[model samples]
Structure formats: C-alpha cells, structure tokens
Target: MLTHPSDPRRVLVERSDLDPMALPPDLRRYEIHLRATFDWGRAYLTNPHPDLGRSGSVCPFVSASLKRERFFLAVHPGTPSDPAEAVDTMRFYRDWFLELAPRSQPSAQITTILVLFPDVPQDAVEPLVDDVQAMLKPEYVGQGLMIGEFHNGPPAKSGLWNSDFRPLRSPVPMLVVRHMVPTDYPFLRDDPEQARMYLELFGDQVPAQLRDQVERERAVGAP
Candidate 1:
C-alpha cells in the first residue's frame, strides 16, 4: 500500500500488491470492487479477444504496466454528485499521477492511475463521470496526458477497431490517467487545439493517415 504524498488518507495500491485483507478496516469495504477491477484488467485489457477486431490486446499498455508494477488503483474516498466537485477530484489525481514514481521516460509511458468510484450510483454515471471527462479532457490533453472515463453505463466511446465494442465499460465507475503517446492521435484529431497539441508532442511521428488532418488543423491555427 502506497500512501499519496500530499494526502495520507488517499491510498494507492499497485496491481501486484492488491490484497483485501491487508487493507485497513476503513478501506476493507472497497475490497470487492477493487478485486473486480483487477480481474477485469487481466481478463480483458491484457488479453486479446476475437471481438476486439485487432491483433493486440484491448489495451496495448496494460500487460507492460502490470508487469512493471506501474499500474495503480485507488477507491476515491468521496463520491461527489456535483460535476464541479467531481472535476476537482479528477484534477487532483491528474496532478498526483504526474508526481508518482517512474517519472522518467519509457517506464513512465506505461504508468497508469485508475481512480475508482464505488459509491457513485448507476444513475449519476453520465453527469459525474462522463461529463467530468469532457470538461477536463482538453486540460489533460494539453499537458500531454490522457484522462478516460469508464462505467457500467457502458460509455459511448467505442473501440478504434470495432465500432460496436464499448471498451471503456468497466465493472465500476472510474477515471484513468496516463501519459499521452504517439498512438493517441485518434482521440485528439477531432479537436483542433488538442490535435495541434498532439502534433507538437509527436511531430512527424503522427500516423500518416492523420497527418493531412493535423496539418490542416495547424494551418487554421488555435481556435
């Protein structure tokens, strides 16, 4: 169990260190949800599936993240119904994610932070989780990081290879934060500012198919 530097009450556990019995009494209640999240990562994210419509695992980074002990999970202490509060909570984790160990390159690329919300009800998923994601995404992308929303509502963001596959769906509502990689252009291309940010970070490394779009957006300048 690793205690967050800034906030001692907030605890983060690596995938390999996840053990319900080891958690403090106050944190034990989250064990079931945490276990489910761990299982889901192994069974889905790290494995290749016929329905994924691609040759690789659902998330190309998960296997390496798990192996390197860079994948972290934490149950948020508060479940704020208001989008404003939720946005603030997610932003805190965004900054915390940058401060966590393995801040260097290569290893840092695979580091991931998954902040789960077990107390949030199914009805509130959209406003609290999805809307917060939309509100904070530009800031996250501009900083060369990615923030993703997942919930049992089965988020509308579909898989790149399979249109019908809702890859963001998770057993629990959560927000995932990770450093942006060259392969993330697909998610940034739709927003001109985000596209320019992506081009600035990745340069000619942007996929050939999207280079024209990025160049066109760059010509238009920041909007």
Candidate 2:
C-alpha cells in the first residue's frame, strides 16, 4: 500500500547533491517523501496545498522556509529505543526546538523541528511515542510547540462520531514539531486539566457551544 518516494508520481526535495554521510539514504528519502506527502496540512516541501488557508495552516512562515526545514535525526551512536533515552532525546530536541524555531526572522521563521528516529524498531516504538507525548505535552501545550509522533502503532481511533480509525499512521517513524491550535482540543480533551488549559489559551477564539461542551465534559468527570 505504500510506495517509496522514488516513485515517478511523487515530487522529491532533490537532496542528492548533499554529502551522503551528512544526509544518508533513508533520511534523504524521508526528505523527498516529506515534500510530496499531504501531511502537516501541506506538502511540506512542495507547493502549498491550495486549501491550506481554509484549513490548518496557521504558520504562514512555514511555507517560506520549506526548503530550509529544521530537523535532526536521533539514530546515530546508539538507538534511543530505551524508554529513558527516548525521553532524554525528546527533551534535548525540545530544548533545541525552543531555542531555534522562534528566533528566526519573521519572514523566514522556523515553526517546528522535525525530529526523526530512523533507527527505532517496531517493538520499541509505541512506548517511546507514549513517553514523548506524556512528558512534553504538559509543559508545551499552549506554549507554542507541539510534538506529533508517527509510527507503526495501530492507528488511533477517531474521537468524534465514527469516521476513520487509522488516520495517523505513517510509512516511517517520525515526530513533528509545530505550534498548537484550537482544533487540537479533541486530542487533549480526555484530560480535564489539559482541557482547561486549552480553554485558557484559546477560549476567545473557541466557539461558545464547543467551550460549553468541553467544560461540561470536564465537570462531569470531576469528583
């Protein structure tokens, strides 16, 4: 069901000229596919999806810096397959993203850091994903950084009325970084405190009905 980026149908980022050791085959292939894939609400390195303005593309600066994507791979030296090391790697990347993403000039801003772990195997991935989300989300939710993980874990089921079951799965293991938005409430809604935090951050822009729903849902769970 998945075809690699070398497929003639897909667009590529053209990273062939870069040093092979600095950008090896797998990472190079990732960069190529990233530009073609319709994730991140856009073809990351390709032309902007026409619907982006009406959809989830909040950071306009992202498109301008598409060719200059800011990312790091966490696979060399040793794999961070160990839970503790995974957390440490995530923390380090989080720090790097916090320091690097926002400081760029307005026109050429870096919205998120693409943290890739090209070496992690299937058995170790799910736990690492859970660890990353649990450890970082509390501190980063409203603070302008988001961490999104993609792996072979069974697709996450839909929270809304039945629609899709595995929409979040990816061909390779990936963790994306970007700012949080109002629409992310569904993903954070299960936790009352996080839901509260979401409202505090975006209540002005959230709809009255949805705001009441989030409150009512939280209040019902409160002991």
Candidate 3:
C-alpha cells in the first residue's frame, strides 16, 4: 500500500518537480513500494542470482518455487528517466521486501530480488545488471541464477512470439529465460525436443530430484 503526494494522508515535501529525490515523502514511499514490487518479480522470475553486499554475509541462491511472485516497479509514472534509477529502485525494494518478508507465507528468508523496467532500453539494462553483479558479486560467481523473459517485439505489436532460450554472459551463474511461455504448462509453452535439449545441457547442474520434477511437470498433457 502507498500514499500519494496530493493525498491529505501524506506529509508533502515541497520541492522542484524535476528533482525525483525531492518528491513528497508520501510519494517517495509509494515510489519505494512500486520499485520493490518490480525488483522482486524481476529478480525472482528472471534472475535469482545470489549477490554479496559490500558489508554482509554471502547471499544464498533463492529457490524459484519459493520466490515465485515478488518485485519492484518505478513509482513516478511521469518522472524523467535516469540511468541510476534502476539501482535506486532496487535498493528500495530490497529494504521493503526485508521488512515484509516475515509477513509473507513460508516467510521471506530466501535471498532473491525482482525488478521491473518501464521505458528502459536493453542497453540501459546492462549497466544495472553490472551494478547488481558488483553489489552481490560474491553470490553471483558460482551460485547465482540469471533469468530473462524478453517480450521480443514492441508491446503495441500483435502476434508476438518468445525467442528460444539462450545463454548470456554477465559474470554470474545465470538461468536466462529468453521467452515468455504462453501456457501454464512448460511443455505446451516450449517445444518438447528443445526443452529436452536444454535439460540435457544443464541437467547436471540441477539435482536429480528436481530434474525428475521438471520432467513430471512437463509431462502433463505433453505428447
């Protein structure tokens, strides 16, 4: 839940409109919530990589099943774009997630984060990824997971299709998800042969039980 600057429920911080940092306290707080939601989802669904902070213990990899839907989004819809905005946005989400974790089911002890980029270019996304790597470099080296789901064409375009899964080099253990599967069933969304190929390539990294689970899940209504 978030309060608005114009809303009487908030204490406004008078400042120039151009200054994103100067937004009213309530707006800023709301911005944090939006940011957190996007980050949580992006990190969990796209990149569940473990990151090491400049001062803290090593972050463990977040299990996808546990961190299914959490994230952060930009708060100010009309705010001007800023290069470092993503990082700031993620920071806010991480803090908020930590506070809200105890309240979530199964408890939010998992080390995962999500992010959403509205109006951000792929090139712009690279640097933010780098920053995240640095902030959590230790966790990313070997145990990190990076997943991405590119929508392919512009949102306005019709009849879009997700690309095949591909590997991306980003200084971390990545599980990049290039396509957005349409069906709830993995097999229906992805070609059986292709998915099998991927299983063959990375199956060794996953536990035997987990691999079996994937097979079982995909086998549902699968030819």
Candidate 4:
C-alpha cells in the first residue's frame, strides 16, 4: 500500500472500524478519476517479473463508490513460499468472494465487477454462480460481476474472464484486464484511447462545469 511519510494522517485503510462483514478488510475506498486506472487485483504487487511465475496477481477484492477517486479493498496473505499453499490461498479467495460480494453495500454498488483468476477455466467458477448470486442480491446496480482466468506472457484476449469468453449483455461496462506478465508498472497505464473511452462511457460522472477545464488541463498535463 502507498504511504505518505510527510502526512502520517493520510491513511490508506482508515475505516477499519466498520463492520468487517459488510465492509471486508480487503475493500479499499478511492476517489475514482475519470481516466485513472485502479489496481484491484494488485497484479503488479503480486507479479514483479513479467516473464516467469504464475499468471498475473489476482487481487481478491471488490470496489464501491462513496463519491471519490476509486477504492480498493483486499487481503494479502503475505506471499506464500509454498506452491501448494499459494494454490490453496487462491482457492480460498475464490470461495471468499461468495461472502464478500453479498456483504458489500447494496446502494453503493458499482456498475461492473471484475475478477481475475489463475489458469482455471470458467467451468471451475461456473459452479460458484449460485454462491455468487446469493452474495450479490438483486438490488446490486451492476449488470453482473465478470469472472476471468489469467496467465503469464504477452497480453492475450483469452482467459476465464476474457471479454470473448464471457461477455456482458447489459450496458454496464466492467473489465478485468489481467497482465499476462509483471513489470515495474504492471497495472496497464491509461493511453489516449483508454482516456477517451472512459470519458465517453463514464462521462456522466464528470461534472459539466469542470468537463471542459479537465480536458484543457489534461492537454497541458496539469494536475
């Protein structure tokens, strides 16, 4: 987690006092930027090397909005030195999602939920649909949560959670772009295309008054 030495009061995980069940420790609150990127899966933190090891990191967490940048909530079991333990840990994450999603706030729900898993196929997660539903009640605003499988190497369009694998029928747009490999800056950086795409899709969130100013500021790399 990022920390600030100059301002010790600036805490990343402050509301740890909330009911953990409804607000799990893994969930984080962030002010979502119109064109900013969120690292929910902590793909970069888990996979330091883009070439070797298991597929990218599976940040087993969920996000919601309380009117700010973006929030990330997740649990890190301290890297497991044992391979078997790692697998078990991941399996636990898959199972835990069942409990976490439902506990999430019904009103502060996001439009999209993306889950990136290991090499496992959708079939592995298909059986958990019932569990997923139980956790995510009908009131949830998102069309549905997307679950995808990921692996290491160059970026590929195929995975358990790939867009081609399980596409969303509803207008709600949520994607889990897993980095096949890791690097210093693994979280996919926002490019011009991505920026424009976000503005088009989530432009509603951008206040009309600052919309033009925001565009102008970006053009000159301000703020």
- Quick one: best lDDT, which candidate? 1
For each candidate, give its TM-score against the true structure: 0.91, 0.61, 0.31, 0.25
Q: Which candidate, 1 or 2, would have the higher lDDT against the true structure?
A: 1
TM-score (C-alpha) between model 1 and the true structure? 0.91
Better of 3 and 4 by lDDT: 3
Worst 10 residues of 1 by lDDT: 97-106
Tens digit of lDDT per residue, candidate 1, span 1-223? 7887768888787665556678866778888888889889888899887778879888989988888888888787656847888788788888888887334666888888898989987788767889889999999998888999999888898888889888888999999999998889889878878977887889968777677866776777756
For model 3, how does the per-residue alpha-carbon lDDT over 139-169 read when each residue is reduced to its tens digit?
2212212233222221121111223322232
Query: Which segments of candidate 3 are over 4 A away from where they belong?
Result: 1-85, 103-113, 137-164, 167-223
Q: Top model by TM-score, which number?
A: 1
Model 1 gets an lDDT of 0.83
Q: Cα RMSD (Å) between model 1 and the true structure?
A: 2.3
Evaluation by lDDT, superior candidate among 1 and 3: 1
Tens digit per residue, CA lDDT, model 2, 1-223: 1122333222222222334444445545444344323344244333433433333334444554544543223332235746677666666656655655563445213455555555667776676775676677776665645677766574464424335434445555656666566667787787767777777777787766477777688678779
Q: Comparing candidate 1 with candidate 4, which one achieves the higher lDDT?
A: 1
lDDT per model vs. reference? 0.83, 0.54, 0.35, 0.31
For model 2, where is the 10-residue window of minimal lDDT? Answer: 1-10
Compute the lDDT of residue 157 as modeled in candidate 3. Answer: 15
